[model samples]
Every structure is written in C-alpha cells, then in structure tokens.
Target: MSHMPTNIPDQSQIWNGPAGRAWVEAQSVLDDMFSGIAEYLTAQTRALGARQVLDVGCGAGATTMQIANVTERCVGVDVSEPLITLAQQRAVLADSPARFILDDAQVHDFENGAYDLIVSRFGVMFFNDPVAAFENLRRATRPGGALRLVVWRSATENAFLTTAERAVEHMLPDLSRRKDGAVGPFAFAEPGAISRMLERACWSRVRFEPVDFTASFVLEALELYMTRLGAVGLVYAELEPRLQAALVECLRQAYAPYTIDGRIRFTAACWVICADAEA
Candidate 1:
C-alpha cells in the first residue's frame, strides 16, 4: 500500500499539529456555528437513504458520521493526519463503519461510479483547483448520482465574523489589508463566481439555496475569541510577551456585546448547492 503525505509543511500541514489540535478542540464551537450549513446541504441532496457516500474534507468526520447513521457506508477524506487520527479513533469508539483516510480530495484516485453521493461542509472552497477537483468527484459518483455542497456567502453579511475579527484586527492591523483569498477562512463567496465554477466542473441542474443559521456560542468572551476568531492568536504571537496578555483582555471587551442570554448569537449566510452526476 502506498503511504499518504502525513508530514507536509506549510499552512496546509499546520492543520495537523498544535494548530490543528486547537481547531479540533473547538469542534463543538465549530459544529454549533456551522451545523446548519451541513444539514441544509444534506437535506437538499441526499438520496433518501444513500447506500454509499463520500465526504470530502471530512474534518474529524462529523458530517461523515451523520451520513453513515443514515446510509450504508461512508468514507471521509482529509489531508491532515491528526484530524484523520481523531476521526479514526472516534469511528472506533462510536463503532461506526465510517472509514477515515488521510488523503487530499483534490486529486485522490477512485473508481468510476464508486459512490452514490458526495457531500461537503464548507470544504469545496479550499481546493487549489476546484475545477479539476470536482471533475474527479464527478467520476467517483455513479451515473444519476447527486452532490451536496455548502459554502460561505460573503464576509460582509456575517456580522458575527466581522465583529469578532475586529477584536483581533485591533491587535494586528496587517490582517485588514490582507488579500481576501487563498489565506482567509473563505475564498469563494461571490454567488456568480460559484455558479461559474460549478458549470466549469460539469455539474448540471445546480441549485443554490441560500440558508441562514444562528450560531449559539456558549464560551466566554476570551475563550470564544481564541477558538472562533483565532486571528487574535496570530497577532498576539507577533507582539512582545508583555503585550499579548493585555491584547487578549482588550479583545474580550471588544466581543462583549455579542454575549447574551449566556450565549453569543451570531448569524451566517451559506449556500446549499445540489447537482447531478454526469452520464
């Protein structure tokens, strides 16, 4: 058997180290924040009771397990070993047949018509080349199969994100001027741009359903800031040792207004897109 790249360097590799652990530790926060995006896409495109499903960028296999609960078999793919490690452990503990693999979805080899459905939760946006990536997905799905995908809308409408980011930007002014793509949380939010990408990938009858969801965050201000808006983490590291603690306190204050009823209520926009596989 060939080995997958488990020790790649760069931001891509960071998802498997302490940074990845930081992200993993906040899965609940993430799930709470984005669960609706996954469910919305699943509901719109699932095959009533899909026999076999593939979850791209499965990220600890949360959405993958959901499909496994309703379907026969599921394979969750991600590029990070730490994530897949957690995913495999979780699958074993859960006694789920959901197989977790450390692999990149963009160009992974698979048999044609091997899967009945393919799904993602804000994962399709990270591909270096989505056109080639999705064309591979098309080959993986059986004829007349379906696809379910979710993607962020735009940065402006997501008040929670913007408000939280401001807290971090105060510490690091550089982020405000950074380009909006290939580094930030989302690179594809333009509705027209997404539609065009799908057409290029050979997806037909694509349906983009706009969905809004409330993120009920239970963490305190500083805790929430670190886990959710970790841009503060980056900037804090840049400052001198004496400054980091003070900046964190400031961020807590900046995010205080969002807290209510013992939870932070934030809204986000996403699209639940569905399409059919090729002939």
Candidate 2:
C-alpha cells in the first residue's frame, strides 16, 4: 500500500511528463552544470554519518549513489518514474546499495522514525503545501535526525538560468513572469518565507547558509545549452523554427559573458539548509 497525496497534481504532471523526460535525456549535461554544488551537498550528507539515509527528490540517483557509498542504508525517492527507471538501471550497473523508489516524498508513507538523515539537491521546492510536505518528512525522520538540502537561492541570482529566460523573453516578450512563481525552480527562493514554513512544520535548529559556486559546463557553443539544458528547452519547444533560431542567437549573445576557455562557467547562488527533527 502507498500513501500518495492528491494535492500536488501540477508537480506530478510536470515531473512525470516532458519536463522530467528532458532531464533524463540530458542528465550528463545537467550534472556537469550542477556538479560543484551537488558535490558539496553530498559531502555534507556524508559528514552526518547517518546509517539510514533518505534522499528526497533523488533525480537520476547521483547523490543517492554517492551517499550510499558511506551509509549502511540509503533510499532514493522521486516522483518521476522515467527518471527513477534510469536511476535504478545505473544502480544495478554500479552494484550500488542505494534503493530507488518512485513516489512523492510529500505524502509517501515512510516508516516512522526510519531515517537518520534526509537530504536533497535542488529538490523540495515544488510542494504545493510546503509546510505539510515538511511535516510529512518530519514524521519520517527519527527525533534529532538531521536534514541537509541545497536549493537555488533565486532566479535572478542564477545567471545560467536567467540568461535563457531573458533570451526567450526577448523573443516572446510575454513569457517574462511565471503565473505561479511558487511552483517552479525558484519556489523556495525566499529564505525568510521558507524559514517560517520549516518552523511551522516543527523542525528545530533550522539554519540556512548561502553558498555561491562557479559551475563549469563543457559546451561547444551556447546553442547546445539552449537546446539541451534546463527548462529553456521547454521554452524552445513552444517556438516556431525561425523563432527558436532567433532565441538561440539571443542566448548565444547572452551566454557570451559567461564563456571562457570554450566552456560556459557561471556563479550559482544557493542555500544549504540544515535542520533537526524535533525530539
């Protein structure tokens, strides 16, 4: 039996559909772009020395496998079946001890007090009711168990993200602002608001530290980025061929400032949030 909530329909649809599939297809490029921050988050999780670990929103199972190397037990949970399928295949190929489950962490019925640590990388931002979601996670962790997750600080703080958005906005003009800002990548951008949500969810010793790292990605040109990396591909999909070409040009120019040594390198700002389950 599984406990999956019905409140997060939007997220379920997006993560299980084309958006999720895109991530699966470009896992290598995306991983390269986020490699530095991902390493930092996984290292922090390993430092916790938790025997039982739960990786929430463990996309493609990279962090899950990394932590599994050091932990006695580890499980990765995600909403996207396609991504989970890839994760499982990789785990099998590597003979990794980590288990990957296809389920939404927000409502999945994890055994009470089962995990000694919970971690995420660029996850935990899409919950419709974030407080409720964290409460669910709280119930799954043992008392005093630690949580260490990394999330983008803001869309404006991320040049790689905003460059593409701005490029498309130059072409489509009307696509500048998202109708629901609280649903996408920047959902947890507001530190104060997220802090309040965690406090209301009964987490203790909550701390947020801002970390900025320069991420470098191998790319022959910015067109590769526009077509292969991030949600910009979705935006490109919505365009006519001519307009897509135009957006590509716009992105190339926008990305020029970040290009060095024939690679795209930009500073990404993120928050490393740490909290403890209430005893």
Number of the top lDDT candidate? 2
* Predicted candidate 2 versus true structure: per-residue lDDT over 180-266, tens digit per residue: 235667777887877887988889888989989778777663565677555567666766899777777777787888889888888
Model 1 Cα lDDT, one tens digit per residue, 151-253: 6677776655665456656556675432233434455666566667677778778887777776666755336446334455444445786666666577667
Number of clashing residue pairs in every model? Answer: 0, 0
Local distance difference test scores for all models: 0.69, 0.80
What residue runs in model 2 are displaced by over 4 Å at the alpha carbon?
1-9, 176-181, 221-224, 228-231
lDDT of candidate 2 vs native?
0.80
lDDT of 2 at 238: 68
Candidate 1 lowest-lDDT run of ten? 1-10
Q: After superposition, how far is residue 88 of candidate 1 from its true place, in Å?
A: 1.0
